[model samples]
Target: MENFDYNLVKVFCSLFDTENLTETARILNISQPAVSQSLKKLRNIYDDDLFVRTSGNMKPTIFSRKIIDNLKKSIELIELSLNQKGYNDNLFYKKNYNIVMSDLAQSFFIPPLCLLLDEANLNIDINILQVNQLEMEVKMREGKIDFAIGNFPALKDNINLISENLFQDCFVLMIRDGHPLIKSDGDFNNYNLLSLIGVDNNITGHSEVVNKILNKLGCKNKMNIPYYSAAPDIVEKTDYGVIMPSFIAKKYNFHNTFKIFPILIKENLIEVDVIYHKLFKNEKSTLTLRDMLVNNFRNR
Candidate 1:
């Protein structure tokens, strides 16, 4: 123990969290070669290959995984001991939180969140990342992402993740104000016959639900677009219908250029959630951010 370098703990923990040499280097503000050297030293000290690079990621060995919890606890203990003499609010720290969400969620949540941060005089950076749903859980567990705000139903079943429902949102059909197929009486029964414009992205799980609805309705003539922003313009210029979140449709209906109709199916109702890894449940910064997000969007 006398010959051990304590500074290597930072590199070890960062490597374990990131599982990517480049990312670990970036987080530690060091070059990749430096990170590699530190990792080599750690491996020699431990007498084991702690991590194995496979498929472009460093997968922790069983020994490394078994010891990681204690190592993390030791680090946390050190941090707590150092900060025990001072009282610091988590929000006062200048840190960057990476969040995953759909573009529609960004439009609905970012403005209010930024406003709240500004009002509180907090020095923090919020980075919005667009990631595949399959990778979201791993990223959060690795601490690469802090939070994910959207309608991710599948994440509810993930044991390692904690999904807190903020509010329930339903789907709505959007069309131009004077859509040709609709009568003046506002009857939407014949609307199913019109071609639809569907969002293809599945990050938020919105598109999957939309696609199921389309399939159930026997709607075959549909064009799949990758973004929600493009749907509004297409609906305005053509005879296509769009199924989207009610809040988003309402936001786009502000100019009275579009008409929104509710989809009454139970599956159309989606629970918007603030999802995070269970590992961060006790973390002050994470808890503070989670509370702020829940409070900001719960009832509205």
Candidate 2:
């Protein structure tokens, strides 16, 4: 361990995160050969093949997995010690942040976030990716995703991830403005009278909860679709009502094309959260962005 080069730690972590030699080089701003040489040196120093190629990914060995958490902590400690004077909030270099969310969340968060970044003159680019709930933890840990913003009940159980509740949103039904099924007084006393266009539960995360509410109300789902953005148009041109987040229903109701009605049930509310990898909790750039999101959107 005395002969180990501390500089190789950065290479090792990057390789572990990306699981590809080429990607490690790209992330570290170095040549491929340099990254390869660093990996070789790390293997030699540890007397182990820390990573093995499997199914196109550099899967870490048992030794690597055991030591990774400590290595990450050491890196954070070193950075903190070096930056005793404090980190500069002004970002001078271009950085790209990948975020995962549903279309419903995109409509609510992207516009304001983009404006804030532009107004601050920050050299940051945001890539809004689609939901891959199963791989979300691994992606965030590997730095492939910076944050996931939306209601994801499945993510709450991961100890390696941190979740910050931004706000509580309830499910609402949207129907055409002059739907015949609706009462003249605008009361939705019975959901069984109207057939619903359901959002695919697998993608939206909140659909299962909404489904439970619908079951209690004895409502019937006529059809299922994967895209939330398509619901407004579908409901506007047809009698089929769609269930969605209240914020999203309101957003699409700007033109008075649809009438929004609360699900009128206790279990209709869902929590929207900002989730990130715990490993990056103390990282300067991560902290800045997380704080920005919480401050601007929490309880709003």
Candidate 3:
């Protein structure tokens, strides 16, 4: 049995593949002096030069030949054992994860998210924080949360984060029930579109999308309000209208109130996506949560 410096194990592997120190250094991106130092350390550990220089190819010494296969096999077995244990670890079953999203995501995606988690029987503490899209990624990296689900307009091209579309929802014109303007035939022409502002300033994306859709539909006139309330709130106060996600409209019965009022546009839908860092891809609990959220929207 040869005593070995595990630090030299990778260097030996590189040498074995290349069979030349210059090539090994180039491949390993190390100086020749560093490679020589590693080789000397390994030789001392083995009590033998390990490789004999001859005809520009380093031939294995008798001592090296005797133990190389055993060394390789041992390393292989250790790696396999580590991987198998990793797959079966209890980490996934015993984690508390926090997630961030808009208020709307809670209303739409949470029920299904909970159902999936319940099935997993995981004792996870989930914190769903209300954050605007701009604050989401930083919150994830800062450990303020583990995941985020919603619109991500600020994602850069360099971002290597992972995201999946949970579901697509179209923008809809929302109004109260029995609004006189909607009573007339094609009365959509007379109604004002509402936008929630101030605390509800996040509606700008929906507002712009609605405008583009309405422009295509030839409905040039639209109004907006910026009060902070659910898309359902547009119905409680005045006849003022709002452009909102079609799913929220449908979920909250806004559709029945004023009708979909055809946007007269070609494109009517936008997707809501769930996002997380790639580093969490291997975290079983996070993956479990991700699958649950996806299935929740998928099955719906």
After superposing all C-alphas onto the true structure, candidate 3 shows an RMSD in angstroms of 11.0
List the candidate 2 regions with Cα displacement exceeding 4 Å: 1-94
Q: lDDT per residue, candidate 1, 138-223, as tens digits?
A: 99877799999998877878988999889888888898888888888986756567888878876878877876776766675368
Question: Best by TM-score, which number?
Answer: 2
**Candidate 3 TM-score, C-alpha based:** 0.60
Judging by lDDT against the true structure, name the best candidate: 2
On TM-score, the stronger of 1 and 2 is: 2
- lDDT (10s digit) by residue, model 3, range 1-300: 254554467567656644678766754557888888988988877779888788998777778778777766665565455546432345455356777666666777778677765765666788877665566666664446677776554542216467787666676666677766764564565533333221234522444565666556454433344432544564556655666676766777734655555454557756677778653443445655676777667525
**What does candidate 2's lDDT look like per residue over 157-259, in tens digits?**
8988999999998988889999998888987666787878888845447877877888888877898988788888889998899888888889899989988
Predicted structure 3: lDDT: 0.61
Ranking by lDDT: 2, 1, 3
RMSD to the hidden true structure, all candidates: 6.2, 5.5, 11.0
The residue pairs found clashing in candidate 2 are: none
Cα shift from native, residue 177, model 1 (Å): 0.8
Error of 2 at 202 (Å): 2.8
- Candidate 1 segments whose C-alpha is farther than 4 A from its true place: 1-94
- What are the TM-scores, per candidate, against the unseen true structure? 0.71, 0.72, 0.60
